[model samples]
Target: MPGRYTLAKSVLSERKALHPSELERRDLPADAARAVRSLAAEISVTLDANAATAATLTDPALLHHIDTRYRELPATVHEAMRPPAGDTGVTIIGSIPLRDDELGRTPIDWQQAAAWAGHPERRCASYELDIVMLLLARCAGEPFGWQGQQAGRLVNNILPTPGKEHEQSGASSTTLLAPHTEDAFHPQRANLLMLGCLRNPDLVGTTVSSVRRVELDAAQRDQLSRPLLPILPDVSYGTDFPDAETPPIPTLSEVDGQHIFRFDPAYTPLDDADLDYRTAYARLTSELERVCIAAALEPGEVLLVDNDVVVHGRVPFSPRYDGTDRWLKRVNIRLPQRLRPAAEATETGYGQCVVAPFRTTLGIHT
Candidate 1:
């Protein structure tokens, strides 16, 4: 994995696609942003005094305490953040009242961020902002983390590493990140992805394409609905699930008359798929590109993507790595308490597990 990259495929057609300007009124209203800051400031004091440890931050009791404060937000904010319906499933919330100078420098990589909580002296200045993200995620679902990703931090930082600019993971910089599900391979993948901006000096775009916006013929749709391919782990999680009966992943499924899809071409084993299935997958990829739009976020803004209804990626940008480059904090959210029943006979846990210690507290069943 080199530090520089060029995308292997194009994510948009020759006709210029929509930019952040095209994404209408998803920004958080000024009044709501003020309310959010007041709430976060009050909670940050409580967390600093009592949280004591990072693990305690995820404790159910604390979460409940924090969640209760969500009522302080404007009712209009609640209505706006409702589970997306019949739309692009992409929401860009701006105006969170952040201080640019307090953000410090973006970490060189996620690995460095993993150690921030342990050493208070090296603590991230974005803890207040992180609390804002946690509060916002609760409006929709429970925020969660993986066993091996970013040392299992509930809120992970998205930044470019000098040595990982060409990888398929979030650390990539110069390479174009093709839109895909947050974690398509696993059945317990996030239903929603919350990306909050701390800084984006160069105005890097976070690309998003929803399944609802894609176009496909009847036959192609049918083929993809039936295609079952294994999307392996990306470089971020270097683990192998050696299960003899691992169920294959279907790129698309319809539930209650709505289409839901999980696609990650970079990790998918397309070579193992049948020619008909491969052809359909390629078509789906193109369709996603056709509808893909880039939401170039700035400081104090956040982007929430429906992981089930949309696939997301990052556009190529040069990272200075000088502490002032683009930086965003990310969180994985699980909505719909009990997950959809496994698509097959076996439990499709896929050998990976979540670190959501408060699942029971949140009324989520395994």
Candidate 2:
């Protein structure tokens, strides 16, 4: 049984977008989605009249309560997150409970949403959906946010910003969000990325490509593992460093017979690499593009990507910015463990820290 990530090769090509019908769909139990929605509505936790701001969202009490309160989600949800034999890493869980008026209009920008601290009415519409993302994220890992990105709010809002349609960040709509490992530059980047669609009136597709789907010769793998490239932070984080002074990191690595990867061609200074290394890197990039799959997530659908195994991006599209434009909520998650022991090292990318609101008791036997 092929998961959504294991779609037919005919559906993929360079910059080719997949129609929504071609992307496989899986639905969570209706009862479970409804129950979670109801549970979120009853939440009374607040700090200074804010229910879902950075401080309240990261509160340890609320995070633990939600995880423990409804730990037994359907098997489909857990199964969708795990890659079968690690062949692919993108999984879509759809049909969570949502209503148009309940979410209200999408926020103008992430900053506008952050300004809702003293106004409960503005944040009320999407509060439940944010909680729902937390509820789903705990099934695989602990949800976290970047201190530099969105001021460390656990859940992030992803929507197109006016006048930024051609930029490389998530706010760009007309420009293809280049394929990259989420937070590839940071040593403590997330182990999994969860994107939950709140409003996608245009059926815009999110592209995904996994390392497991490609084959590299031993020579090529060795070259890729030599820490020859340095990935810089995307512009969305509002951080920058002298590229030459930054330490190089591996585009691919192997540990205990398993593969770990870091890749961000847009941020990686390819001109700095030698001819042989660049050739190998070029091959890897070509293979990834050949296997890339574009899947459009419908409203209430959540896509979970294994950060180590997949590089995800978005296709270029025109944004209406008319309240119904494509909107998504993203969560960065930390798994129980990492492939590299050095993952524990603090290389604070631009002084940004993790905003973990909860102490997670995730099973770490993997």
Q: Highest TM-score: which candidate?
A: 1
Give per-candidate clash totals. Answer: 0, 1
Question: Mind giving the per-residue lDDT tens digits that candidate 2 earns over 168-278?
Answer: 688889877878899988766788899998888777889988898887898998889887767777778754466444678888876667777898877777777898898
Tens-digit lDDT string for candidate 1 (116-165): 53345555456566677777887767778888787667888889999888
Q: Estimate each model's TM-score.
A: 0.87, 0.86
Local lDDT at 101 for model 2: 74
lDDT of 1: 0.71
Lowest summed lDDT window (length 10), candidate 1: 1-10
Off by over 4 Å in 2: 1-25, 44-56, 72-86, 116-118, 243-245, 341-350, 359-366
TM-score of 1: 0.87
